[model samples]
Target: MEFFKTDKIFDFMGKRLPFLGLSSILVIASIIILFTKGLNFGIDFAGGTIVQVKYEQVAPISQIRETLKSTKYANSSITKFGSDEEVVIRITGSSSDLTNDISDEMHKILDSTGKFEIRRVDMVGPKVGGELREKGLMALGLSLIVMLAYVSYRFEWRFAVASILGLAHDVTIALGAIALFNVEVNLDILAAILTLLGYSINDTIIVFDRIRENIQTSKEDELKELINQSVSKTLSRTTLTSLTTLFVVLTLYFFGGEIINGFSFTLLVGIIVGTYSSIFIAATLLVQLKFSIGDFRAKEAEKLKSKREKEKLRAMYEQGTV
Candidate 1:
């Protein structure tokens, strides 16, 4: 069934101003949030302790949190583990020794409250957290470099640069949103952001691939017209892919529980932003990079001239228009 006809509503020329303005506002707001409020880094990034305990029966997280609050480990987070019978506690104390003591005290508290088993106890040092932060940034940088190389080699340098720019745009916007909302940035959130990078790029590559194909086949069309056609042709596929993925993401976001909430929210935002970037940011980037309209126009003019010459010769030979 046809959902909607391909109207030129998103024509780059017509809607460029609005799109650019909105994107600029989003990006700037995100930057301000990042610098001012900053992200609430989780125990995985900040030095803290994680304790996993298994209960003989299911226990309420609120009860666990209250129990820890009553003890010396006042600032603690208690959440369910994989199953109802298991609970995970995270505590961020002032000192490493205090953190460890807090973990031990938590175990004793849970044991006293009910019959439970301590499954795992782990502590992350501030130094270690710093190292993890460095590594995460390095991984992000490497991914961008690799994407730049792959896209540049596959298409053109301009396309490669544009694709990377689009990816950056999505990542920054996602990070900014997270910061603005004061969401915890843990290993999982980092993982989600990285996943978003790859996902957003996939959409971009698809659009770029179509653009490249249009460039090759439609030699007579102007660059702007070719871009419009290319994006329009791929509109259905893009919409279907995004909508199908969003259906699953929305389900997870609504019902995935606290553990996966951040991950799902990140994915949801990424998908929406990714789709938008693929069309406006990435394609508009080509024009911004000075893609040389002259090159495309010259090629089209040559083709037109060749066609006219052939037609004129045919007319002379056939005694037609002269």
Candidate 2:
């Protein structure tokens, strides 16, 4: 089960600068794309009409698109949603009871080709979409804040700070992939992002916990060497976990159908970035932040000292000596 021997000592921290630089450039590029290209927000946030139609027979997507081209709905985005017989049409704006108009138009156009049933037509107003977008952003912001607090409490603030930076790196990379590919962001994508944050933090916490344990137990003098050794020691666990997760995500991407494609795609990009951040971004930032064994040991000593003082005080009170 071990891909790397327990005694393995790869110098991951030795080549951290290059990785950090690479991550920085990626983050910057993602920001540029965010401003320049922007994300393709789906009907969930972009305020549009979603008309889901189910056909009795096999309805070719190209034929559907071609039929719509002759009508006002020609500019609509059509995709084979769940199955070969089910398709979802998304048209941005025009949501003031426009579903009927679209449904009638589609029925007239599609009646000749095949008898299809309009399963449902959902309309999202601009106001609702704006609210959802704001809520989504707020959720992401709150998640980061909560993760920072939790990591800070679990480890040191330095480790927590490093964890946040690492999560940001993963998120930026995922978002970058979506923007680069022009994938439509929907509720599923938002869920995937939240999942990514949790997953990435879990990886970061595992490594940070190892770093903390190593600092506490080992008398290693060189901080860089200590980090490198800690990372090397956990390399197998990280690799195995990430690969297992990646395999599932790849399967989901290939076979989960279009409905969850955004979700799978986000996870696919996220797993790689999260794994890299745990190894390079988080650990390297620790080195850059100059985390020393003494710092952690000093905190440990303070905790132990405080515990001993409380114990002594309790004993004195029992003996009526206080």
Name the top TM-score candidate. 2
Q: How well is each residue in 1-322 modelled by candidate 1, as lDDT tens digits?
A: 3344666434764576688789889988888889999988877788777778888888667777777777766777777765788887777853555644554566667665687878787777777888888899999999999999999877778889989888888998999988877677888888988999998889889888888777766654566777777777777777888899999999998888767888888888999999998877788788778776557446656877999999889989899645
Question: Whose lDDT is greatest here?
Answer: 2
> Model 2, range 270-297, lDDT digits (tens) per residue?
9998998898889889888888788789
Clashes of 2: 0
Worst 10-residue lDDT window, candidate 1: 1-10
The lDDT values for all models are 0.80, 0.88
In order of listing, the candidates' clash counts read 0, 0
Note each model's CA RMSD in angstroms: 8.2, 2.2
